[model samples]
Target chain A: MDIPTYADVEAAHARIALHIHRTPILTSSFINDLTGAELFFKCENFQKAGAFKARGASNAVFGLDEKMAKVGVATHSSGNHALSLSYAAGKRGIPVTVVMPRTAPEPKKAAVRGYGGHIVECEPSTSSREAVFAEVVAETGAEFVHPYNDPRVIAGQGTCSKEMVEDLGELDAVVAPIGGGGMVSGCCLTLSTIAPKTKIYAAEPKNADDAYRSFKAGRIIADDAPQTVADGLKVPLKELTWHFVSKHVEDIFTATEEEIVAAMRLIWERMKIVMEPSSAVPLAAILKNKELFAGKRVGVIVTGGNVDLGKLPWAQS
Target chain B: MDIPTYADVEAAHARIALHIHRTPILTSSFINDLTGAELFFKCENFQKAGAFKARGASNAVFGLDEKMAKVGVATHSSGNHALSLSYAAGKRGIPVTVVMPRTAPEPKKAAVRGYGGHIVECEPSTSSREAVFAEVVAETGAEFVHPYNDPRVIAGQGTCSKEMVEDLGELDAVVAPIGGGGMVSGCCLTLSTIAPKTKIYAAEPKNADDAYRSFKAGRIIADDAPQTVADGLKVPLKELTWHFVSKHVEDIFTATEEEIVAAMRLIWERMKIVMEPSSAVPLAAILKNKELFAGKRVGVIVTGGNVDLGKLPWAQS
Candidate 1:
C-alpha cells in the first residue's frame, strides 16, 4: 500500500489549484470574544462544490490520464462527495457516476444531477450501497474514487490545511470534524511534516462518537447505524483514515447534538456564512472545552456549507 | 444643508479605519450564471455589527470631538442602526441610548443591550418614537445619529461603495436596496465623483416602493407605514437621502415580495452567505431585468444579514 505524503499534498494542490476555490480565511471578533480564542476559519465551505471534498475530488478527476479520464470516475456518496465528484468531473468534461442510496435527500440527489453527474440509486444500507457501486464500476469501467479512504482523496484533503498553514502562519492547533477521517488524515499528512508543532484535534458528535471511542480504545470502532444531526459525520473511520488518525491526531472531542445545532446557528448569525451542522462540531468542541483552547491561535476548518435551507437543524420541527 | 462628497467618504474611511470591517468582495459563478450578469457582491452583511450601518455609525461615533464624544450618541431605530450605534459607542467607550419601539423583537433589544447601549422603549408609532426620542436626547444631551438622513451617516455609508469600486475597478452599474437610502446616497456621493460613468440603481420592494415612486415623481414620496418582508426597507426616503437619489440614480427598480424572498434564499443556498431580505432586493432587481444587466460587470451591495432565522421568509407557513 502506497501511503500519501506531504509531497503528494503539494502535488495535489498544484494539480487542482485552478479547479478549486482557494477559499478565504474568515475571523470574527465577536466569536473570538465569546470563545476566548483567536480562531482562523479556513472556509472550504465556499469551495467549488460547497465542501472540502471538491479539493480531493478535483485531484482525482483532473489527475487522470487521457485514456482513464475518458472513461471518467465513479463514487458512492449520500452527501457533499457525490456533488463534488460530479462537479470536478464535469469541469474536466468527464461523465461521473454516483451510487447514492434511495433514501438520500432529494436536494442532494438534485445537486449531483445538477453538476452533470449520473446517479444510480441503491438501497439505504452500506452493504447494498457497496454492492450496487461495485456493479456500476464493473459495468462502466470507471475509476473508483472511494469517498475518504483512498490515498488520492486524502492527499487532496491535505491541500486545505496546506493553505491554512500558509495563510495563518503558525497556529497552536488545527481542528476539523472526523467522520471517515479523510480531512483529519489529510491534515495529519500535511501538518506532521511542515507544521509539526501545531496540534491536531478531531471533533465528532457525541451521538456518533465512534472516532473518539476508537482513539481512546486504540482500535477501530465501527458503528453500523449511527444517527446524528451532524449527518455528514455518521460514518465510521476506515483503515486508511485510522492509520493517520492514530499516528497524528492530538485529541478527539465530542459535542452533543444540541451543542452542534447551537454552534451552527451561532456561525450563521455571527459569521454570516452558511455552514452545515458538521462544520460546527469544531466550534462546539472549542466552546465545550474552552480551557484547552483559551488564548490559543486555533485554525478551524469550515468543512462544508451544503445544507438544505428548508430543513435547517434549528428549524426542524 | 451640506451634501456629502467623495472627500467626506475618504475622511470617514480614515477616521473609522480601525473601527469598521473592510469586508470582502465575493463572487459566485453559480449566481452569475443564474442571473446572466457578472456580479461583485460587497458583503456589508459581514460588516461589524452584521450590517453596513456599522460604517456610518462608526464614522459618526469616532468623528465626534472630545466634548461631544463624552456626551455619547442617541438614535431611534428598532433595527440594525440601533445595534450598530451601540456597537460604535461601545468601541469608543461612550454611552449610547437607543429609542426603540416596545414591540421590537426581544433579540434586537437584547443585542442593543449587549453592546452596552441604554434602551428607552417607546410606542410603535413614528410620532411616539420621535416624541420619546426627543425627551431622551434633551435629558442626555447625546448627539443624534439619524439612521440615514444625516450627512455624517451618509458619508460613512459611502465608504462601502468606495471600497467596492477600489476592489473591483469600474463597474458598469451599482445597485443597492433603498429604504431611508443612506447606502444608495453614499454610493451616489462616492461614485458620482470617482467613477462618474458608473450608473447607480436603487432596488425597492413593490409593497414598499416609496423610493421608486419618489424617483418617478421628481420629488420625495413618503410611505407612512408600508409593509414588506424586507423590514429594513420600510422607512421612506428622507430629505438628505433624497438629494443624492434625485441627482445621481439612473433607475429605481421594484421587486415583488415573493421575488425578494426567493432571491434571499438563492443567495443563502448558492452564495453560502446569510443575507437579509433587503440585500436580496438588488439581486431580485437584476434577475427581474436580466436584459438590462446582462453581460455587464455589476456591483451589488448586500446591505445586511440580521434576520430572525426562526422566521425565514421561505420557511414561513
Candidate 2:
C-alpha cells in the first residue's frame, strides 16, 4: 500500500485551497500565562462544517474520477466527517448517503440532513454501523470514503498543519487529537518532511486511551468500551493510520476527562471560541504536561467545534 | 460638548490601531440560509477580554496624558467592560479599580482580579454602583471612565465599525445592540459619515427595550424592572448616547428572550463561536426580520462572548 507523503499533502492543499477556509491562528495570553508556553492554535473550528474533516471530505469527493463520481459517495460517521462529506457532496450536486449510529447527537444528524445527505440509521454500536454501511455501499454502488484510514483522507487533513506552519513559521512541536489517527498521522507526515526537527504528538482522552497504549506497546490496541466527553475520539486507530503514526509520531499523550472539560471551558471563556472536547484535547495535554512545554513554541490543531450546547459538560457540572 | 463626528472616528481609528485587535469578519453560508440575508459578522467576541469593550478601554487608557495616567483609571461594570478596562490598564502599567455589582458572575470577578485590577463589589443597583465608584474615585484620584456614556469611550467603540467597513466595504446597513447606546452611537456617527447611504439600526432586547422606546418617544426613556438574558443591556441610555442615537439611528428593533436564546444557540451551533445573549441581539433581529435584509449586504456586530458557562440559560431546556 502506498502512503501519503508531504508532496501529496501539498497537492491536496492546492486542490482544496479554493473550497476550504484558511482558518486563522488564535493565541490567548491567558492560556500562555497558565502553561508558560507560547501556543499557536490552528483554529479549524472555523472551517466549513465547523471542523477539519471538511478538508479530507472535499479532497476525497473532488479526487474521484468522472466514472467513480457518477455513483457519488457514502460514509459511516457519527461525527464531523459525516457532515463534512455530506456538505462537500451537496456542493458538487452529487448524491451522498451517511450511515450514522442512532445515538449520535441530534445536531449532527440535523446537519447531515441540512446538507442534503441521505441518512441510514444503525444501532449505536460499531458492529452495527459497519454492517449497515456495507449494505449502503452494496445497494447504491457508492464509493466508500473511509473517515481516517485512507491515504487521500490523511493527505487532505495534512493541509491544516501545512497552512499553520506556513502562517506561524517554524514550531518546536505540533499537537493534535488522536482517534482513528488520521489528523495526527497526516500532521506527522507533513511536519516530518517540512520541519524535520519539529516533534509531532497526539493527544487522546484518558477514557479512550487506545492510541496512547498502542503507541507505547508498539502495536495496535483496541478499547472495548470508551467513555469520553470528546465523542470524536471514541474510535480505535485503524491499520493505515497506525502505520503513519508509528513511523512519524514522536509521542501520544492522554488527558483526563476533567482536564478535557477544563480546557474546553478555558477556550470558551478566555479565547471566546466554541471548541468541542475533541478540539480541547491538544490544549488539555499541554496544560497537563506544562513542565515539558514551558517556554517552548507549540502548535495545536483545534480540530472541531461541533458541540451540543444544551448538553455541554460544563453546563451539567 | 463636541460630538464625535465621522472625522473624529476616522482619527480615533488611526490613534488606537496599534493597541486594539483588528478582529476578523466572519461569513457563514448556513447563517445566510437561516436568515435569508448576506451577513457579515464583525467578530468583536475575539477582541481582547472577549468583547468590544476592549476597544473603548484601550482607547481610554492610551488617550490619557502622562500626568493623568499616573493616577490610572476606574470604572463601574458588572461584566465585559470591567474586565476590558482591567486588561487595558494593566498593559499600560497603570492601576485600575473596578466597582462591580455583588451579583456579577464569580468568573467575571475572578477575571478582573486575574488582570490585576482592584475590585470593589456593591449591591446590584445602579445607585449603589455609582456611590461605590464615586468613593473609589475620591479616594484614589483615578480618572472615572463611564462604560458607554463617555465621549472618548464612544469614539473608541466606533473603531469596531471603522475596521469592519474597511474590511467588508460598503455594507447596505449595520445592526448593533444598544446598551446605554455607546457602541451604536459611535457606529451611527461613523457609518453616517463614511457610508452615508448605509442604514443604521439598533437591536435591543425586548425586556430592556429602553432605546427602542426612547427612540419612539423622541426622548430618553428608562425601563422599570427590566429583564433580559442579555445582561449587558440592563443599563438605561444616557443623554450623550441618546442624542447621537436619536439623530443618526434609522430604526430600533427588539428581540424577545426566546429569540435571544435561540440566536445564541444558533451562533454556537452554526458559526461555532461563543456569543453572549447581548451579542446575539443583532442576529436575533436579522433572523426575525429576514425580508428587510433580503439580498442586501448586512453587517452585524457580535458585541461580546462573555457568557458564564456554568449558568447557561438554555441548559434546562
Give the poorly placed runs of model 2, Cα more than 4 Å off.
none
Interface DockQ of each model: 0.89, 0.87
Model 1 bad stretches (over 4 Å): none
Best-performing candidate as measured by TM-score: 1
Clashing residue pairs for model 1? none
lDDT of 2 by residue, A1-317 (tens): 77888888988988888789999998988789999999999999999988999999999988889888889999988679999999889888899999988888888888899899989999866678889999999999999999998888999998988888899777998889999898998888788888887889899999999999999999999875477899999888889999988998988899999999988898888888888899999999998889889999999999998888878887656
Q: List the RMSD of every prediction in angstroms.
A: 1.2, 1.7
Task: Show pairs that collide, candidate 2.
Answer: none
TM-scores, one per candidate: 0.98, 0.97
